[model samples]
Target: MNMSTTSTFPQTDGVMTPRRVAGAYLAEIRSECLRYLRNPGFMLPLMLFPAVFYLMFGVLMNHGHADAARYLLASYGVFGVMGPGLFGFGASLALERDGGLLTLKRALPMPPGAYLLGKMAMAMVVSGLVMVLMLLLGVFAAHVPLSGAQILGLLALGVFGVLPFCALGMFVGTLIKGQGAPGLLNLVYLPMAFLSGLWFPLSAMPSWLAAIAPVWPSYHLNIIAQRVVGLSDAPVLAHVWILLGVAVGLLWLASRRLRRHG
Candidate 1:
């Protein structure tokens, strides 16, 4: 006598209900947040460095100069937010890919975007914390005069302003090895901050340097930030458009690379 057996598998599309999709994203975000929270080495520096800079430059060095404190607050806030976007997305993604975690995530029963979204949420959380610290130092410690609306505006900017850097970092992550990601990102980060006039007003830089400052995304962000703080009357629309274009372009390129390489 002979026996025959047959097996049937569930269709992949049938498993992805809206409720499950939402849960997957939430779970991923929670895990990502918890993982970073547990890593004090990473979180401490990411959160503290900007506050330290703000305290040193905006408060102590300024010696109660209202205008200088206000200016540095805007500049350092942009500088602060850039770190998480670049390091959180760029370094983490590259390291996970190298460690085989990214592949395992792809093989798991979760949304394709859950991983990236989780990291993005974590970065925003860090960015918000850093921004809040900067604001507190600016308001109470440094005595920079910021109205309620201005404080809220800068907070909102700090939260969402990380996206452009996230896209750029994502692209860079896809292009480099895990070990090289941090170094390469720092190369991009610090120099971009300086060249974008995040440390000093463009007017204070060389004529050629000031002329090229507009080429950096941070310059536009700083412009908008200064406007938020009532320090600059520069038009905001052009900067917004430029940033939006840069983010979309980098995200497009990053997605293509991830699909091909991963």
Candidate 2:
């Protein structure tokens, strides 16, 4: 059989039912999650860096400043979520594209969306883990006061906020060679984190530097996150809309690139 030809699976009544589609999606998600978890090189850094950063900045450095702890908790949570989305999607997609795995997947009976969905699912799961760890440290270790509602809201936002970064990762993966993806992602990731006020307040920087915040999705995410703790006065919906727009635009660009490369 030609590898380019789609494989056929057993079906009932010659129709793909909702149950079957759901099963396929679950299978893909499981596979992706396992693949991510098994890679210590990837998973360790993704899971550890954010937590460590939170401990250093949000806990130790905050030095009994509840306000600072609350701020860093939210900022680091956003930073934590960005890793699994940006690096996960960027590196995985680039490797798959280079290894011809994408072509093989295309020939399979799986829904095309399953590939992206699996990645998104993995990123969200990791995001949730990061948020939980951060929350524990913030509430107990750092003594950051947060109501139950605020905690829940922060977790929800962190998980969903990975969408734009995932789209961004896909775009970057499609644009670069597989071997260079990691370096490229680090360069973009670290600088964006600093510029977007994830590590510290952008207001402390030069006015011109602070002016660049809106250009990065991370900045908008931080704005909404800060708003959750009463640090920012910007409308939450506005920041969400900005992220939604960026996600849509990046997804479109990535799809176009994939089509050309495919």
Candidate 3:
């Protein structure tokens, strides 16, 4: 029996090598990317909605206006990054939990964190793609002038800036059933975007609305993006701290809920 088992299991001791652990993570990430890419209902809206909106408002409407193009580019980039983090985690996770996939994965022998990390990796990738699409429209279509560093900075921001929203989405996923997640997230998503001034400058909003804009993560993200693109001189350290805090706090809450509920 020992000889037969040793022949079947190469490791012999039943210990997972480091390579095996890494492969598990890579496999999970690959599966996540494939799953989302294959779902047109999910992928199309996440990828195109912001790009279309940017083309209409940032490119066509703001044609030949460099300042408008720059501002909208920064704002819309934040808007674009929000979708993947929110829907990808919030809606899909709820649906997966309903389908019993989360439980199945928990019963698997893989690392516990791999599941969430896989979703996060996919979100970051989608966020990066969305930023690329927006930057292309801003540069070629709108004729916005941005240096290489600025362009790279904005791209990096979109890729990493998605974490707080991901945490928020995770928390939301733990709160409701699958069918309700999308609608509830939309309620949070659209209003937050508008309130954060992603659609337009807060200067145009009422004084009270403008005063409270800083409460939104998107607002702080927009400030950092604006600073990166040279549209604003706002100090970035405070905004960075705020976003970090939001991400950490929401993630802690979500993990607790997932443990208790899932």
Q: Cα lDDT of all candidates, in order?
A: 0.89, 0.88, 0.90
Task: Summing lDDT over every window of 10 consecutive residues in candidate 1, give the lowest-scoring window.
Answer: 2-11
- The lDDT ranking, best first, is 3, 1, 2
User: Model 2 — TM-score against the truth?
Assistant: 0.92
Q: Each model's TM-score, in the order given?
A: 0.93, 0.92, 0.95
Which candidate comes out best when scored by lDDT? 3
Candidate 1, residue 84: Cα displacement in angstroms equals 0.6
**Residue 44 miss distance in model 1 (angstroms):** 1.8
Off by over 4 Å in 1: 1-14
lDDT of 3 at 43: 81
What are the clashing pairs of model 2? none
Expressed as tens digits, the lDDT of each residue in 19-39 for candidate 2 is 898999999999999988888
Determine the backbone clash count of candidate 1: 0
| Candidate 3 lDDT (Cα, 0 to 1) | 0.90
Question: Per model, how many backbone clashes are there?
Answer: 0, 0, 0
